[model samples]
Target chain A: MVTDKHYAALDQVLELAVLINDDMTRSLAQDGLTVSRTHLLWELRRRGPSTQRDLADALKVSARTVTGLVDGLEATGFVTRQPHPTDRRATLVTFTERGVRTVEEMERGQQEFARLLFAEMPEERLDCFSEALGEILIRLREASRLTDPRGGDQ
Target chain B: MVTDKHYAALDQVLELAVLINDDMTRSLAQDGLTVSRTHLLWELRRRGPSTQRDLADALKVSARTVTGLVDGLEATGFVTRQPHPTDRRATLVTFTERGVRTVEEMERGQQEFARLLFAEMPEERLDCFSEALGEILIRLREASRLTDPRGGDQ
Candidate 1:
């Protein structure tokens, strides 16, 4: 039955996630950064200096949450808040020099990691895998939405 | 490039995990049960009455964690402790009637979920997908190991 196969794949997916998450945590621990913080940095690097409100919107988190993350990152010397050049009411969250270096290094590391994971696999199989992942993601979103308590509102 | 494809797949996988985890949390919250407690119940249903120590080993968690979970489950009427038949120093963690039903329902729900996710996919594609997953998982584990600071110990 596909049930067994599905469960086996799910098991692998869950384990892979755990491995990936643990690896990220261990590596990030060295820099005193967390997943959320790393995400913020990556976003900043990609989008350039962004206001806290803009970051909150892009990250799909609350303004308060963004503020807290920025505060923590600022405290840790990875980011700083500067007065917006064009708007007095707005403030920009800019990366420090070290922050730029760190994000670039992390980006390179991620690329290398992805390459190592997929480089040897035949392109045809990688295509199939990518297709399968897309299909699964669609169903997973539907399933999550169906199960969500605030389903109708979303 | 395969880099883009690999990244697309990774993004999907990460989003899928978030969706799955959120779905589970929402569903479990309805029953006043967290994931770990449900795991304990499921394990109890599968293995019958088990000692807390046995559960700790099976779940790969510390004894203190098991004790806390069992205590919480017991307080919530999902499980109870009984002195082990042969070992005076050990106690068995057995599910209550409600616990049994809950775990069975969760198991059924899991099966249905997997079926819904995979039943429509063609067998050939599913085979390829499974193979790709296995290969990806191997590399993921290796990557995690390589990045892990305590690599040599494992």
Candidate 2:
């Protein structure tokens, strides 16, 4: 049986997730970027060039979705798609110099925002909260794997 | 100074939030609904009815976005928009019987999914996890209010 406390906690988790995403998305949009596009750029910027399939798998999105996102990024000159070095069947995506700069700016803004968020909480509570959130994430990822085998295909 | 543990926890929290939302959105899509649209319908079904602006506020979306969503819902005969009884410029949105039934089905599926997510964790761990998540959410929300005065504006 689900207790009231459990229900309340779950609800709060869901709400917080939405609010945080919304805020982040808004922040990115203020700089004329979408979170989805920024996510793709950030991946390339952080991990160096990678194949479309690999990028799709890392982002947990469909290949077609990644293709569309890459198309937009390529059009904007933020990313480039080239033939993979060894895999003729796959294409490699890499960030442009402009994309790298944009990602760095975004990272700075995000870090500042994160610092403000953590600054408000008690140090001990923040530590405990982080640990608990990590544990729950592990459990949820496991549950997702069991129920949704499609992710495993990636 | 942030410890390695803090960084790990933060990354976990961020990744978990993304995965859970993705899974939930996919689950809702399988039922021919988007998470945002389903949220509007659920709120209407539960609260009896509301205006587009009110729904937008409750769902944390823009009124223009709500208008588009409501238009799609109305096109599918899932809901109806009528003039507010006392406010000529405002409109009230009420879910149709079909909408209510669809939302109830969605809720049932979500509840079952949540149950499966929590089933593997021990009771004590679950309690600790939930409490920690709740505290973080509260602190995040409060911090956001301080940093962004328009954070929750719809």
Candidate 3:
């Protein structure tokens, strides 16, 4: 039934996501970075240099959109474009020294933020929560492979 | 140290959020409604007949944004604006018959979505996940109250 507590928890996830997103937006704005921009930077930091096409694929954005993000970041000296060593036609994007610093700062900030949000939560509980979330994520990924726009009939 | 599995879990939560948001966006677009628009509709349905000011507050939007949403809904005969019985200067916003039907459909769609996303989980695990998520929400609400921008940096 819709009144079920489990359903309420699912709804809470959505509500809490909105709140956290607001917080993240404000925090990123202070750094002059949108979440989208920071996300690209984070990806580059994690995966090291990548071609524009690869980034476009990884971020699920259009090639033109990737160019725009890369251009914006490059213009600001947060990233640079280089000819790919393996592929002559494509360009690779990597963090500038400044970009690396921002990624570090963002990562540190996120860690602190997570700790604050989860402070005093017992370890065993978190383990269970983490495992539950992991399993749910796997299920979602699998379910997404099916072609039901309504998510599913079930 | 930062590469710990717990950090990975936290990061997964953000990734999963992006995926879910993308799904919601695509789902809402099919019905000619944006997520923001449907979120307001959902709120109105759950709480019933709120003032524009209250809607703005509840949705965490500006008064002007609320007017725009209400105007759009009103234009489509999905909601109505009428003088408040208690307050002369204020108006109440409530769902029309069409609006109620839309709300019901949206709720059912969301349930189907949730079911698709969480199908086949064991009941005991779901109970644990629900309880864990509930506790995490409480902590998040508590953490949000702190003044420091880095989520209190404590």
TM-score, one value per model: 0.85, 0.80, 0.83
lDDT of 2 by residue, A82-127 (tens): 8988889999998888888888897777666566556455666667
Question: Please, what are the lDDT tens digits per residue for candidate 3 over residues A7-125?
Answer: 76578767567657666776787445787787788778878999989888777678898899888889878999999888799999988899989888987899887776455566777
Q: List the lowest-lDDT window of 10 residues for candidate 3 chain A.
A: A145-154
TM-score, structure 1 vs. true:
0.85
Model 1, range A1-154, lDDT digits (tens) per residue? 5567789877776676666667667767756799889889988988999999999877768899999999889999999999999999999999999898888888787777678778888989989988887887788777766666555223
- Clashing pairs in model 2? none
Q: After aligning candidate 1 to the native by TM-score, how far in Å is the CA of B4 from where it should be?
A: 2.8
Better of 1 and 2 by lDDT: 1
lDDT of 2 at B150: 66
**For all the models shown, what interface RMSD does each have?**
2.1, 2.5, 3.0
What lDDT score belongs to each candidate, Candidate 1 first? 0.81, 0.75, 0.76
**lDDT per residue as tens, model 2, B1-154:** 5445555666776787787786777677754568778788888877787998888888767899999999888988789998999999999998888887888787787676667556556676667667666666777776666656565522
Scored by lDDT, model 3 comes in at 0.76
Model 3: DockQ vs. true structure:
0.41
Cα deviation at B133, candidate 3, in Å, is 1.9
Q: DockQ of all candidates, in order? A: 0.58, 0.41, 0.41
